[model samples]
Every structure is written in C-alpha cells, then in structure tokens.
Target chain A: MTLKEIKELLQAEVICGDHHLGTEIILAGGSDLMSDVLAFGKPGLLLLTGLTNLQSVRTADIIEAKAIIYVRGKKPDDQTIKLAAEKNIPLLSTPLMMYEACGLLYQAGIPGVSPANNSNKAND
Target chain B: MTRDDEFRQTFKIKGRDFSHAGGVSTEIKEILQEIGIPTQLIRRVAIASYEAEMNVVMYAQQGKLILSINPETIQIEVEDKGQGIKDIELAMQEGYSTATEEMREMGFGAGMGLPNIKKNSHVFLITSTPGVGTYLKMIFYLDHEKAS
Candidate 1:
C-alpha cells in the first residue's frame, strides 16, 4: 500500500518527508532492535518501531527502508528528524502501540519480515 | 566518473559515541549511491559498514574506517583500538555476544554483528587480539553492467 493510505488508516502524523506519502511500501516490519532491522529489513520496507533515536533513522537509511512509523506516539528528536529529512526517509507517528500498529497494518495486507527462511538467508 | 576511475576516503569513529554511531556508514552509503552503485550492492555495503562502525563504538576506544572505491570493487578496512575478540570463530557464531545491558538497550549487542557483516560482504576478514584491538576488511565487487 502507499504510505498515504497507511498514514490515513493509522491516523499517523507525518514527521518528515511529506512529499513521499504517495510512495508505495511493499513490506512492513516492526521491531525495536536495530540489529534485527538491519539483518532482515528489505529495501523499500516499512519500518514500525517505538525506538525514538537517531539510530532508528540511521538503520532505515542503511537498509533503504521507504518509511518509518513511530508507534506508541513516540516521536524522534530534532537530530533524528533532521537526519530522516536528509536521507529522504519519510517518518510517521501514531498513537497506537507497536503491537496494535503492526496488527493493523498486517491485517491490511502488509506482511511482516518472516524469519524461518529470512534468517538463514541473512546469515548466508 | 566512469568505472575505470577510483576514489578513496578515510573516516574516524570514536568509541562509545552512541550519539553518532553509524554516521560513517551513512556517509559511505550516500557516496556509493551518488556514484551509481546498484541498490543491492549499496545495501550490502551500508549494512556491513554500519555493523563494523557499531562494533568500534561499542567495544573499542576508537577506530578508523577506510573506504576504497575502484572500478572493480569497494573495500572497507576498519581498524580499532580496544578489547579484541580472543576467539574469532566463537565471535563469528550467531548469538554469542558480550554486549552489556546498555548496548542491548540501544537495540544492538545481540551477537549478530560479525555474522551479519560477513553475510553482507563479498569478502570479509577479521583479526583481533585479546586486549590490543581488532582489524576488519570487507570488500564488495561492483558489476559494471549494473552501474547506472
């Protein structure tokens, strides 16, 4: 689904990259761990997390994630938002907790980053 | 600049600097993207470099990251001064991390750093002493046809 649709469905606030709302996001992965995100996240994936730090933005940029949704009403600091803008990664925040936000997206057809096959491939 | 040309840069990473961890890798990723590296290759480079940088920040006093870009390859050499891994083999194992609680809180120290770096690089090499330091070298081959 497009980022615009996800934002509207979740009632998320656009924190950065307002111009990219129309971009399509293929996969959604929710995690609080940056390592897991780097190990499993695919390019153009949508990242949902509660961690509000500069590293979150850096992780999304490293994995080339299309956008980040900050769950549980979490918001990034100024440096984090600035970095997101610089990297062209769209940021959004929703009042829903991580579990609820992820469920809403998954129920809406957004697939989570599975591990059975993904883990082996990542280690290989 | 075409494939035949080459460029190189060295970036310094200070240890225990959580505030700016992964900054070097981000810069390298941007440089690779600007140079028209394929998305797949750039992702690999970015992941490998970021992992390496984080290692230095978490475990070392400081480190130097050298990025060498040539027509045929992109190579990163990370050398750090700090507590080095005694058992490189054990360190390579997934889920064998010695990261502290603080590190885990930052969403790292899951013992996947070295393995993930190896998985992302075409060539990965690591050497370390118990107390001296660690040295890592990673290379990614560039496909000329894939170059934009």
Candidate 2:
C-alpha cells in the first residue's frame, strides 16, 4: 500500500513529508518496543507505533523505514519533527488506537512480519 | 575533529537529565561515519553506543561515555553515579531490567541493553558498587589491514 492509502484508511494527519505521500510501502508492523522494531523490522516495512519519542524516529532512521504512524493521536514534539525533517522520514499521527491501526493496515493489505526467522537471518 | 593521543574523543556524561541522553552516541556515530567506518562496524558501534547511552540516562543520576577510535580498535567507556546493580549476574541475563515504567514506556529498559552491547562488541566489562556507582566498557576490534 501507499502512504496515501494509509493516510486515508487510518484517518491520520501528515505532520511531515506531505509531498511524499505517493511513496509505496510494502509491509508494516505495530509495536511499542523501539528496540524490537529496530531488532525485527524488515528492510522494506513501515512502522506503526504508539511510542512517539525522538528515539522512535531515530529507530526508524537506523532501519531506514518507509514511514512512521503515531497511533492514538500522538503528535511529535518540535525536536522529533526537526529530526524527522533532518532524516527525511515521513511522520503521521492518527486518532485510531494501536490495535485498530494495525487492523486497518492489515485489512488494507499490509501485513505484520514474523521476526523469529528474520532474527536468525539478522544473526547470520 | 581531533582525538586524544591514544583515544579519539572522551566525553563526560551527566545522567538522568533525559534531554541529553543520546547525544554522546550520536556524535560518536557521526565521527565513525566521517572516518569511513564500514557499515557492519558502524552498526555494531551504534548498537553498543545506544545501549550505553540509555543505561546512563535511565539508570544513573550522573555518568560519562567515552569514545576512543584507532586504526585497530574502537573503545567505549560508560561510568555512572546511580545506585548500582544489586545482582550483576542476574542483570546480565536477558529479560531482566531495573527500569521504571516511564523508561519502559519509551521502549528501552527491555533488559537487552547489556546483552546487545556484549553481542555487538568483541570485549565487554561491567563493574558496579551498590552505593558508589557503575563502570562499563566495550571494545570492538578491527583489523585495519583486512578492512582496507
């Protein structure tokens, strides 16, 4: 799915990267653990999370994620926004809670990842 | 841009301020990148740097992280002035942490900090006193000949 679809489906606000809504995302996952996201995320996946710290943006930076969706209407602070701008990471905020956000994205055809096998690959 | 005689940069960290927690690690990452460190090495340093960064921020009231880089090795030292770990052996175990709810909510303090650092680094050490403080060090050895 594309960022455009995610914005529409989750009813999210595009806090940054409005011009890049056309960027396509292959897979997505929802988790509160930034370490797990960094530890488990696939190369091509988008991250949906409730933890909207600057570290969250930094975690997205490490993995080079497509975008980040802040569920439950959490808008990032100025520092986080500035970092997102610096990193060129697309950031969004949604009123939908974490579970619903994941469900909508999944229903929209974006699926969660199985990191057990991926962890082995990361180890290798 | 210039490092100490043997080490690259030695920074003093003040813990629990929360705002400046990740600053030292970010700087170290930038320097290593500028010096043309390899991706695997860079990522390894980042993981260790970040773990060490969070440890000082959340666990200690005050601490310092030092970064030293040379042709052969990259070394990081973190010293903290918090209440030291009660059981070093158990704390080394995965899925163990003394992190508060606020810290955990931020997605760190997952009990993987030490383990991740140990995994990424070639050599690791941790020493702590219950009333005094804690000192941690990690070294990543690089064969410059092989890398070049």
Candidate 3:
C-alpha cells in the first residue's frame, strides 16, 4: 500500500515526507521495544510502535525502516521530531491502538514483515 | 574497519554511560563504510561490537572496548578488571542473561548479546578470572587472506 493510504487508514498526520506519500510499503511490524525491533527487522519495513522517544527514530534509522507510526496518538517531543525530519523517516501519529492499527493495515493488504522472508532487499 | 589494507583507527570505550553505549560501534561502522567496506561485513562487525560493548556496560561493571581498524580486518577487544564472569560455558548458551530489569527495559535484556557477538566474529575468545576481570577478543576479516 502507498504511504498516503496508510496515513488515511490510521488517521495519522504526516509529520514529514509528504512528497513521498506515493512510496509503497508491503510489510509492517508493531513493537514498542526499540532493541527488539533492531535485533529483528529488515530494511525498508514499516514500524508501528507506541513508544515516543529519540531512540525510536534512532532504531528506525539503524534498520533503515521506511516509516514510523506512533500508535495511540503518542506524539513525540520536539527534539525527536527534528531528528525524524533529519533522518527522513516519515513519522505518523495515530489514535488507534497498536493491535488495531496493525490489523487495519493487514486487512488492507499490507502484510507483516515476517522474519522468514526478511532477507535483505535492495533499497531500490 | 572492514577494508583489506587501508588504514587504522582506535577508540577507547567508556563503560559508565548508558546513553553512549553504542558510540564506538557506530563510529566503527561509519569508518568501515567510508573505507569502502562491504555492507554485509560492516553490519556483522557493527552488531558484534555493539553487543560486546553493551555487555561491558551492563554486566562487567566497567570496561573498555578497543577497536582496531585495518585495511584487511577489524578487531574488537573488550578488556576489564570488573567483576569477572563466573561461568563462561553457561553464559554462552542462548537465552542466558544476567541483565537487570533496567537493561531489559532498554530493550536489550533478551539474552542475545553474547550469542550475537560470537555469531558475527570470525574469531572469538573469552578469558576471565573470578577475582580479577574478564577479557573478550574478536576478529572479522574483510579480505580472503587464506589465498595470501
């Protein structure tokens, strides 16, 4: 699904990367643990998380995640916003809880980035 | 440093700061990439170095991560005189960890740190003295040195 559709599905406001709304995303993962996500994530995946911290953006940058969705309307602090802007990690804040947000995305044909198939893909 | 023969850089890890835990590894990864190291090897070294350094911060009580960067290889040596590990054999097992709740809350208490270091290093060694300290050495080669 396109990032634009994901933004609408979760009722999320695009904090950055508005021009890249047409970017396609296939797999998604939801977790608040930055280390867990870092330990088991593929590049270009979408991360749905409730944790609003600098480390969250840092984790996304380390893994090169496509986007970070802040579930439950938990907007990050200003410093984090600046970091996200710098990293170009397209941030989205949503009112839906983690499970519901993931489910909606899954039903909309956006699948989880399962580890079995998480072998690295070209960033192209 | 994952290049085959470029240059060398060294870093001294400070074990007290939790916020600065991954600093050395990040620097190493950046240097390796800029030195024309392959992404795969760089990632492996980064993971190993980061995990080893975190272990020192969380468990060793205090230590330093000495990173040696050369054109042909990357070596990470963790040396400390802190409370040494009591059981090396048991510690190497997956799912075994001594990390406290605070460390877990930071998202790294999953007991994968040691296993992670061993898995990524082309050469690994650990030595410890109960009353003295612990030392870990790891090496990852960037070149096909066997042919040389």
Clash counts for the predictions, in order: 0, 1, 5
- Evaluated on chain B only, candidate 3 has a TM-score of 0.85
For residues A1-124, what per-residue lDDT tens digits would candidate 3 score against the true structure?
8999999988999876687788889778898765567566667789999877666776676666889999998888887788778768888989999999999987886666554544423222
**Distance from true location, Cα of A26 in model 3, Å:** 3.5
Q: Which ten residues in a row have the lowest lDDT in candidate 1 chain B?
A: B139-148
Q: Where does candidate 2 stray beyond 4 Å? A: A22-24, A42-45, A107-113, A117-124, B1-7, B143-148
lDDT of 1 by residue, B20-42 (tens): 99999989988998989889899
Q: Looking at model 3 chain A, which ten-residue stretch has the lowest summed lDDT?
A: A115-124
Query: What is the C-alpha local distance difference test score of candidate 1?
Result: 0.90
Backbone clash pairs for candidate 2 read B13-B64
TM-score of each: 0.90, 0.83, 0.79
Q: lDDT by residue for model 2 over B39-99, one digit each (tens)? A: 6787777777777887878888888777888777888888988888889899888779888
Q: Model 1, DockQ value?
A: 0.70
CA lDDT of every candidate: 0.90, 0.79, 0.76
Interface RMSD of 1: 0.8
Order the candidate numbers by DockQ, best to worst: 1, 2, 3
Whose DockQ is higher: candidate 2's or candidate 3's? 2
Residue B18 in candidate 2 has what lDDT? 63
